[model samples]
Target: MSDRQTPLLGPDVFARRQERLRQELITRKLDLFIAAPSTNFQYFAGYNPGRSERLIAVFVPAKGGSVIVCPSFEVERLTRNAAVQDIRGWEEQEDPWRLVRTALGEMKPQHGRAELALEHTFDYASYLRLAGVGGDWHIQTAQPVSERLRIIKYPEEIALIRQAIAITEASIAATFAALQVGMTEREVAGRLSEEMRSRGAPGGGLVQFGPSSALPHGGPGGPKLAREMVVLIDAGSPVEGYASDITRTIWWGDAPSEEFKRVFNTVHDAQTAAMQFGKPFTTRCQEMDRTARKVIADAGYGLFFTHRLGHGMGMDGHEVPYLVEGNETRLEPGMVFTVEPGIYQIGKFGVRIEDDCLMTETGLEVLSHRVAKL
Candidate 1:
């Protein structure tokens, strides 16, 4: 039983989240599970890593709420912000693995054996260390179960995501208004981040621009925005631990070439098509991605549309239920993510329009407005 804490959420919400995890474990036939700071710690535990070295391991049993083995210093922080019931602490001087071993013992099954599970991004060293001490355990690490649990969003999570989307949209609009042909991409991006910071949004995203856009993640600054080049901005804001990602290709000049207009409209249309039928209980993301990719491929920039349509956006910037080929996760009402379809011509220009979208009972609602083309 959880104690009554002012910062804690109601018991029902926490139990509901825990119940979902139990179902995922049962479906995967697991006895015990562990996850590190990346997705497992971020979404499941509702905690972000301040440093890469601060590893967090979450343990989920076949039944009951999970136990977290985190550094002793984080106990107060966890109790204040998260809703976990079983909190295990570890000291830096002592090997953290011992604490984990104890927690796993508490949830021990009848056979003196436990099945281990992990998120795809779990640290290899951490796994080795834990497994070294973990004898008689069938360690199962893969993508299937983690995918099911994280692919969709819940209502409370969606609310924070919507807030993230709102802040990101304001930053994009501000970025354009603050833009000048002579100003470098770095300068523009700095201004964009400042706008969000001023508004109390802590976690910001990339402001990659100009030739930078050519590199996919070419990053910010150094080059000036030329007449024909597009200023591609990929930015986000974190609200209540949920992150919203939005990318828009902004043109620097008023002289929009026919090709430019055509590409922009195509990308825009692709985004619309992918999000068209997004709703509760409809989880067909492969079809949604195909719809977006086909538009770019048919228009003759198939190779240029290099990346997948989008990824799941939630507690972390990226999560499960990825929007790409070979993925079968169904879209659900509470699930929110981006629909970005791009076509980049090497040494030329690339166009990608991204907008945060939520699957609702009625269909889809664009969380942020489409960035206006100049």
Candidate 2:
């Protein structure tokens, strides 16, 4: 568990974020940046307005103040949590896109084809309606702007993720202690969920046993855990929007096969080598994946290791800076991601060991505690 206490981010933090993004907007030569009711909304606006068919959004200009648009009925509720004062609420029958156009008019002088960056969560229907709003608007992805800021963690964000990982690790440990033979995967998953919530976590995680472990993302149900079967638990709990992800595979029975032990060790070593790599803030993302993949392939189980080494984790479980083949993004400090290397033998068993890792000035800091042993 982290010694740092996770506290609520204050208005100052959001203000800093908004200012930073505005600079990014100017750098990208964009006119305006719009965020829907997604993580980006929660990120910049300091609250979530909840997702609906209604076109609720936050509009930030490249050089001026921001505004929010939501249903007129929701104005009061949104006001309580939002820092933006210029809240424009439309009635049920009103054209919300017109309101968006009005907000744009107040933002900047409309040059030729004013470029607008839309948060990726907006549906195609929303995009079409937005495009129809006219004013020579050009809608492009907000990826470069959003991903650049979010990919790097502030110290507070790291603390929150650590707290979340502590909760999930404790919940998984508690759940396994109470496990017994013949328990359905759903029952076990339910118990895990209960454990996490009881410990103040937002939710539970994934559980699999025996052949189900081979599926990687297998749902929990139908399978009954038996002695000598492999047990896999992949979980993440969020703390104040930051996320934690961890996966641990273990042999359930007292008697374990030699092959299982060997596979487990191979995965453990692969993850270790990848984590301990001495590169500092400049190693290509795929280079890290290759480092781990080589270890698995050397053990003659490369074919079974089908998936990427890991993915970036933050407000979303899977985000930018993916540690996989072909991605060339360089790893930088404050970036957090998972280093999970797994080998699955179809219809038989699989082994995976994952740890939430933070890249540092020196090396990777393993955030989650390693609980499973050979």
Candidate 3:
């Protein structure tokens, strides 16, 4: 387990996040940022009021205070958890869009048109409504703003992610130790899920066996296990709001095939190369992907090694700083992502060794290092 204590994300944390975002707004000349009920909303608002057909949003102004708009019935519950004090509640009979328009009008600049940055998750219908309400608006996506702040995690966030990986690794080890020869893939997946939840992770688990393991994402889990078969288990669970993802492949029953061991070793080598080379403020995302992909390609499995090397992980399983081709984003300290390398041969077996990786001040630290490899 992580030596760091569990982080208590209270109003102060959210307040600091909002202040940092406001500075971004000033730099980008964005007048205001509006977030719908989503992860982005929760990040800035200090709490999520749950999803509903009724409109709910958080407004962060460039120079003024933040506000939250929600249904009248939810105001009481929202107030109890919301970090922002200005809460506007609209009744079912009233149009929530009007309230949004009024809030935006209050934050409008004195000279130019109001430039609004809407969160990425806002639907088209809502966008149209917001656009139609009154004055000239310069509306655009808030992706750049959100990505700037969230791409690099805080120390507390890293601690939570580490805790999550520790829990998931323990769960996977316990479940794998109890496997039998005749168990169905579904049974194994269920057992893994139970093990994760029982060990304080309430997320999900996935399992694949033998021929089904050839598929990268996954396939049906009805196939029964047997001797000389391949087994793949991809498991993840959340600690607090942070997430953990890990993939491990094993040779079940009797392991006697030279090909299976070679493939596993190749994947292991690829992951090691990428993890070792990733440095803070030095490596580009595409460079990391190339480092891992080249290792597999040199081993004569170029075409078989499909997909990107890794992706960013935090509150959402997949976030920013994706380690894929053509992405030139530079690596930074406190960025948490995965380093998963795989080689799949159709109609044969597949091998993937994945671990959550964190870039620290000096080097890349594999968060899932406690888990053993092939």
In model 3, pairs of residues that clash are: none
In model 2, what is the error at residue 338, expressed in angstroms? 0.5
- In model 3, where do residues sit more than 4 Å from their true spots? 1-7, 370-374
Deviation of model 1 at 253, angstroms: 2.4
Q: Give a tens-digit lDDT track for model 2, residues 162-257.
A: 999999899888888888999988898899889888988777778999888988888876479888888998888888778889888888989889
The TM-score-based order of candidates, best leading, equals 2, 3, 1
Q: lDDT at 192 for candidate 3?
A: 85
Candidate 3 per-residue lDDT, tens place, 310-367, comes to 9999988989889999999999998999998899998888988889988989989888
- Provide the lDDT at 142 for model 3: 98
What Cα-based lDDT does every candidate model obtain?
Answer: 0.72, 0.85, 0.85
Provide the lDDT at 257 for model 2. 94
Query: In order, how many clashes per candidate?
Result: 6, 0, 0
Q: What is the lDDT of residue 91 in candidate 1?
A: 82
Candidate 2 has which clashing residue pairs, if any? Answer: none
Ranking by lDDT: 3, 2, 1
TM-scores for every candidate against the unseen true structure: 0.86, 0.96, 0.95
